[model samples]
Target chain A: MLPVATGEFDLIRRYFTGLGGDGDGIDLAVGDDCALLSIPADRQLAVTTDTLVESVHFPANCDPALLARRALRVNLSDLAAMGARPLGFQLALTLPSVDVSWLAAFSLGLAQDASTFQCPLVGGDTTKGPLTLSITLMGTVERNHALRRDGAADGDYLYVTGTPGDAGGGLAIMTSGGERHNQYLLERYWLPTPRLAAGELLAGFASAAIDVSDGLVQDAGHLCHHSGLGCTLVWDQLPLSTPLVDEFGVEQATRWALSAGDDYELCFSVPPGRAAEMELAMAGAGEQVTRIGVMGRGISGVSCVSSDGQPFRLEQAGYAHF
Target chain B: MLPVATGEFDLIRRYFTGLGGDGDGIDLAVGDDCALLSIPADRQLAVTTDTLVESVHFPANCDPALLARRALRVNLSDLAAMGARPLGFQLALTLPSVDVSWLAAFSLGLAQDASTFQCPLVGGDTTKGPLTLSITLMGTVERNHALRRDGAADGDYLYVTGTPGDAGGGLAIMTSGGERHNQYLLERYWLPTPRLAAGELLAGFASAAIDVSDGLVQDAGHLCHHSGLGCTLVWDQLPLSTPLVDEFGVEQATRWALSAGDDYELCFSVPPGRAAEMELAMAGAGEQVTRIGVMGRGISGVSCVSSDGQPFRLEQAGYAHF
Candidate 1:
């Protein structure tokens, strides 16, 4: 049971209602049973849902605001992976108990990110329960133009954005000892940018794309699973963040780069001849990516090869929260 | 940590992925980053989110299939309140452990409702945590056709569909000693129908609308608050089901009807001039309603009037989760 202060706060009106935009596409906002939105008839709506539970998906005592930002960023990454532009979002948050300050900090972080992402909080629900945040992000894309996982063909080159696995490095440092204040790694972990521009750009060039959440290898395996093909990763070409490499060493960094989760970066495949044009388009967009593998036929799943072209084995794939 | 058996279940592919409609308006169904939906150009998308947590919202040992149906039906009630037609839904479930039989029953209930309501299951997430379920239901309505709470005017007649307090009596029976086996009361509590037809009909005639989740008085208060008016519910006119009255008597049933929560029936305001035509339309639609009150200006919040025209005092308004 929560303290009576929970009711005194009037969470919907006091906190959640004022976070979104000034009624751009929203015909109605919070306080109602349903929020109505007009998505220009030319575009199709893209929706995704992601949930984070305390002590399961995240540290139990993480900063509330940072947790809020991280939760939203991860869900937004889903839309980014789909090449969908921001529309709005609905949050269904379950809490064990209500602490005014904790709620204040949490809402502040949500408001901040909601503004940054240009996605308003169209509606939401708050209930007393174990602490968990589930966000169903809604976005829009041109009709029939969404980047899908099954579109990539054999021989398509696999590409990844930013240096992957810095988030896992951050997690390792945070859990290992008193190095939780490592700014770069922690920022990467909690606030990995949702590559909206890159996703929208790639929608036209990349045959298929997905954001790196469940580690590079496992997530690529998802693409292979969906596309009915296999992929080979050039072990030496996997991008390793400089900070991660410098702190954890190349061996540890490579392991994190390939096998750790929470990387919020895009992984896509470019058709052979379209690579040059896609790269050229991406150069000026401030989104850097490295070609790490190529999709091929007649294989079971994702395989990796060292620079010498010898098969490399990854001891474990990635995290699964079941 | 959850049992390694959770990983063994592959909850999404096995249970959730196959619950939705047969690829209608769904470009990509379960595995993708976002569920792409092609909402017709002439329609506006109406969205709502609802969550239920174990121990707080329900008994710890409620039947899995019934719980799943109740959860989804309650959320669908919101869509009905808005006069929206069902499109699809997303479920984010947090489970303490993976039970194969429980998952099977829960998904069966969800699939049943998905077919019954014509709302497909578009996507979902399953995670390890204290048991909780969050659903975001999406639907569509013609532009400017949504039945909303802000449209009622002073002097409008307040009407409610079906009997309002049966669910409350059902809950009372369940929580008191050993009346849980009372089929009529328990069924009313667990399987309250969403007044979709009534809502769609009301959209064309009612001034304002909301579904009864927080009891009659409080939900009517919501309509008043949003419409910038006050409403008076005639206690004598409050609809009480025969089963509830049979067990609890008239006085007790009146209290439950006016104050207890979890009635999925719709409470709406109809303009004075449209009552006859509205009632005629409702008659042919096979939906029955009772006019219980009237909206007025200058009075704050919800007031109750006895049969003799004196103010009737209600001990409590409704349930509030904090």
Candidate 2:
């Protein structure tokens, strides 16, 4: 059973007001007609918006706290891909009914993540509807230094941070009930960490970057399409979690890495001559940078090849909401 | 019947990309991980988000084009209240299924408003869900010059721009079907003009301001609550439409003006000495500015009284979404 909401204003005051401190870049927070934000003079604002619907983005009975975190994290991932430092976000949450306990847990999770990422809740609207969460995150990047998808060159080397297929494997586990007790996998599905630090470090070194939300290959194809180039992803070089490899064989793991979605890891391209320097920089920052593929001058798509130079046929490219 | 959407990406490319131009303070538009925005050095960003859900926010079968316009206009009204100049907006649209005709009409209405307000479409997300539209609008105001609700003084005279309760009367007409042929009231409900020019003019003169969204009396109460003051509104002073007076009678029209919501006009307070100056300023700007009441140093709430100084009783203060 869900707790009843007392009223809209009361709910917002109780659950959202203290989500984060107002001092960072927000001149004014909630309770006003609009929030006043002061962006640093040297930085440009990076803005993105995303929406998640119940039963479509997650299971119907999923934990509210995790749902809130996922909703904010996915949007933060977009900022990370653009090499922007998270500043704050506004939430538009629609609920089927006022559920006090559900809201309490959800707000607690949101507050925790807001604190963790230093992205405060600035302003938002709460309305009655089918359960849905929409977040618009704002960040700042140095003028002309923000990473873009159309900057990849013909000889750019593709690199990815973190394992690509773990979230998909986690989703598969949750859906199939094959490993119901796999907490790691469940955590991967519910709590994706945006690669903010890695992206920031790669800002000057990377030619093009994108966060892997719609599977590695499909998103790589997006990068290629924007850059007017193609890519050759080495199947053996694809990163996979130990648990994913243990549960699913090499072939399945590779397939998930290429075709499954919701990774939330940064995949970027570096100029061929700067690959070694970029790797050193990432290593110095204590982040993993994996060499995954290379951009080529060809049709805009990703071609997968095995270690022995054999072509691998993928069943599907990635997940599409439509 | 609704038309079918070709695909998500294709639909966005066809209908939404051309919604606004790229040069108006937008460094990067759509097709990127995040849109980049450049705020003037002397200005602070004013951000606000609002969500509209089908059946809850509007009639279930409301026209898609009208729905889109209402969604954007309501958010723009918030900017007006803040005395901010419109810059750009991000949209998160969720639909139950692909509806090509609906999307085309919706995007057309959205584009028209974006162009009219000079608030371009910066970024957005589209997902599959029950029909919902969430828009986060961004604007700019000179630092420390934003009109706030907490700035009213004890001796401030209260004022409003345009007639209040017209939209409520419009809504009443739509609900009862008594005057389906009343195009004026129907247009009032479907399309509200935000008092941008008036709000901008009020920035330096008005002590505090707010958009009359939750009825004139209730929203005035909000101003009082923020300013730690009280207000006494002259019941007969409220501006009412001629049609509203003719259809609902003077008594009910007075009640609607006092308690019915969705006016979307600016309600503000001016220091006692600035009333004439404000009137002159507004006259110069060719906008209506009506003096309706006065702020007082007392318990916080709106007190309504008739022309004879007798207290007026209201059954409900305002509309509450919950």
Candidate 3:
């Protein structure tokens, strides 16, 4: 039998109180019934919520620390897509039993991301049940500058930040256990960074944006459906990391790039003439921005063309939760 | 086997999109990567989150509609304790399978409460998992006026809005399978109302405030611990409804009032001379304010005395989550 641990209140006090320390915007913090935050006068609050359940979102026995980072990062990626600056977040964590080491590592990873992104942990709830995590993150964006999915024009160039297929390739590598210690792919899978800086820079320039969570094609379909436009992707120009290409070859890597999900990179559209200006703005942001497609007036969906100008087809678009 | 329903996104669009219909402060509603809220310039945002799990927070097979109301109300009670007015909320709901009838009933209760409390549903996430409901509520309070748990003075009078222990008695009746259809007790358990009006009125008058979630005595001990003071409760003065007394004898009802949990009322402290003003403020609010104790400088916990001036002790202070 497992040893009994301290109750919920004590566990929270011992582990979670000192996180995201008393920042200027927080009028009240943990230990209170509700946290009070002073939103800056000129900014509107952007809120998003995401929940990860065991075995559904992640594998059954994934590392606790890495799970913590991925959970928070996915929510942060939503803010990035909306062109919002991080403010703070609240966590609701449910567990089947108390495990001190797991809690310690999880909180450490959460604290690291919170500090790095400047999003403090304002308040949270911990309960007993099957392991599940729910995070509601709040951010700030200028009143009319929030990037929407319906703003793309008929002839805009579609661009994505960072390499698109590395995380998906990494997930495959981790699951197959062929090369268990491939540092690049494993790290990409475990610790994908949200493109906060590029998102902020894209606020005034990009016409539309979305994070690629459910494959490039499915998410592009989302953009087209909302904007009432059709999208065409040039298959050869799809960004692929050298490691992924080396491991899986060009054809397989392209498939992963187009059809695999959980990449967490931002895909947005800019007016064709402003591509150079957007490129110059992102030059010093340390992320490579790739123009992979173009939007057009027609039916509202995504189509792919290979280097030889032939249409490409795949088995499925992306993941769907039912 | 159960029949397959629509996917997660379709389910949300079908049932939840029309809830809490586009309110004044919401700049962006459901269909976006993030919901945008425009906070008033002079108001601070008050935030709180809570999660309820199946078979832990409530019995198995409980009514979905009632569970929805209870989940949202408990979070609203936290905002009420901070003297904040409702702004909006985001929900993260998890379920074992797609049950159309269950989803319809749950969303109905949620929509009803969202309308009544003036807290609209701004954003949410739905996923497939074991039954769980998590809500994060946001509200607004004036700067420097939000109540805290550390503001009580040594001589402040401790008061609780509404009769306590009814929910506990209701829970007892529910679990015992006797008098299960008693509307008053069952409704008290299923739809505990947050003291929003009283809390808003107590903003400037109450010294320290907390919502009585974990029984009266245990929650009072929380106030005393935070305020660096001690409290003494007059056992006979505990406000017990006639129905609760009739169902359970006086001694058992008193025990429930002291140690049973899940009472969503406001327990607060007011200065000695402001009782009359506080009473006048709460007179027409549809709930009685009962003064059951006083604060003093001593050990930080709560003690009770019988009407005959003898010490009264119970087996435990309140419910513990472990």
Candidate 4:
């Protein structure tokens, strides 16, 4: 529910005036014409923006609270890639009509996330239009410590965090799957946990890192192509939850793992010898880091292999925005 | 017009990629999940964002090129309030339907203005939805040199640049007013000239500043209230072009100046001692700077007055967003 007949400035002040998340490096927060932030003396600021529209990015009847969460989390995923710590963010909202109740829930959800993440809401604008959200997130990383897509080296182990396919499975449930399956899967798709902690930890250990928004296979291909390397993926070794296998057959789960989207997981690559140390660090942080593949010198594409070394195939390809 | 069924990534690359305007501070441009910018060692970054919705901010059938200009210009105006110089910007565009030709025209207009202002496109997002555009602009200034709304002092002269009522008149012509009377007004309203140069110059001399968006009197009230000062505006000296007066008569023009909105001009205050030097600087730059009022020690409010210091009543107030 949004506020009807509420002016732009009042709406902003009532819902977004203060989250008080700024510290150390943030110089100024909201209230002025523009917010000001500072990069630590030896660091650069990582920034990314994303827009989500009703019926395009999510179902038309999507929950307002979840929509806000997903919108912010998607931008946070980009920050995760750069090994940047969340500092602050700006929001631009467009709505078809005002519904005060909806807005209250949305703002409450946004406020909770901002508090939990410690990223202040620095600036934003709201207008009347089809429900749309655009968020720009800012983060910081030490100079030269930011991860690059083209930095993966040959013989590096490709790793991923958490289970894959939960989000895709969730989507499937949404379209008429069982009550049990739908609830679990819907939660995965609607409320993804961004891998900020894992990403920051991997900054020094991983050669390159990317967040998996598209399917794992497609995203891995991006890393490989950018890094000028080929990858061999171990299908049997993929990390999957028991529920995923029980809800869908093993083959279906594997296919979803390969081609499903919206996992918000981190996929990265590190040298072979550093894998053990990285694993220990991830464990210490309670992160579920899984080694799924290895970067190779000669090939330029990803090859998914079965336990017997046979090539794996899927009927559906990864998601494409087109 | 926007592209038809354009894939999301391709649309972003086509419209927003490679803009790296004013690259001296850009650490990374588009293509990665997020962008990285290196804040200058001695300057602080000023950031603001704005969103414009079709049939809300502008008429539903407004020109694509003009709409694009307005979207960016409005955000730039916010930067001007802080006396920040243009740096780079990001855009988020959403459309109800794809019209390739419209996209081409809109992008061309945006690129032209971006280049003209020396502010390049740094990053943005595009998605399918009702027509809406969001822009976040970043600029820089010497540390603590930012002009804010809280610094106006008693006895300061309240000044404005260019004329105030043209755009308001144009808006009247656009909605229900006669075409002959509205032609010039509409043009001014649709294609506002941002007070970039004036703002940069005034940054050094002005005590405080804000852009006139909600009409002269309303915006003046904002400056006064924010700075905890009172303003007495000389209605007789309110700037009006001869053409406007001839077309709508002085009374109507005065009404428009008082309450009409959409004029992207600068309204600022300066100490009395700097008035002469400020006028000289503006004249040397071939710009129009009008001294229309004065700041004084009184309750924070705006009042219209005659040359003889008699209070005057206005027929209309500025546009109210609510």
DockQ of predicted model 3: 0.51
Against the true chain A, what TM-score does chain A of candidate 2 give? 0.96
Give candidate 2's error at residue B229 in angstroms.
Answer: 1.0
Computed on alpha carbons, the lDDT of every model, listed in order, comes to: 0.86, 0.87, 0.86, 0.81
Model 1 residue B178 distance off true place after TM-score fit, in angstroms: 1.7
lDDT of 4 by residue, B163-226 (tens): 8898877887777745465567777888788788888888889999988887788778778877
Write out the backbone clash pairs for model 1: B20-B121
Off by over 4 Å in 1: A1-9, A179-181, B1-9
Judged by lDDT against the true structure, how good is candidate 1?
0.86
lDDT: worst 10-residue window of model 4 chain B: B1-10
What TM-score would chain B receive for each of the candidates shown?
0.95, 0.96, 0.95, 0.93
Give a tens-digit lDDT track for model 3, residues B270-321. 9999989888778866658999889989634787886677676787778888
How good is model 2 by TM-score? 0.97
For lDDT, candidate 1 versus 2, the one ahead is 2
lDDT of 2 by residue, B1-322 (tens): 0111236777777888958565568998888999999999899999999899988989887888889888888999999999999999999999998788998899888888888888889889999999999999999999899999999999899999987877887888899866455677677778988888998899979999999887788888888888998888988988888987877788888888887777789999999888898899899999998899989997347888876887777778888778
Comparing candidate 1 with candidate 4, which one achieves the higher TM-score?
Answer: 1
lDDT of the structure predicted as candidate 2:
0.87
Per-residue lDDT value at B241 in model 3: 86
TM-score of 1: 0.97
| Candidate 2, chain B, TM-score (2 decimals) | 0.96
User: Model 1 residue B63 lDDT?
Assistant: 90
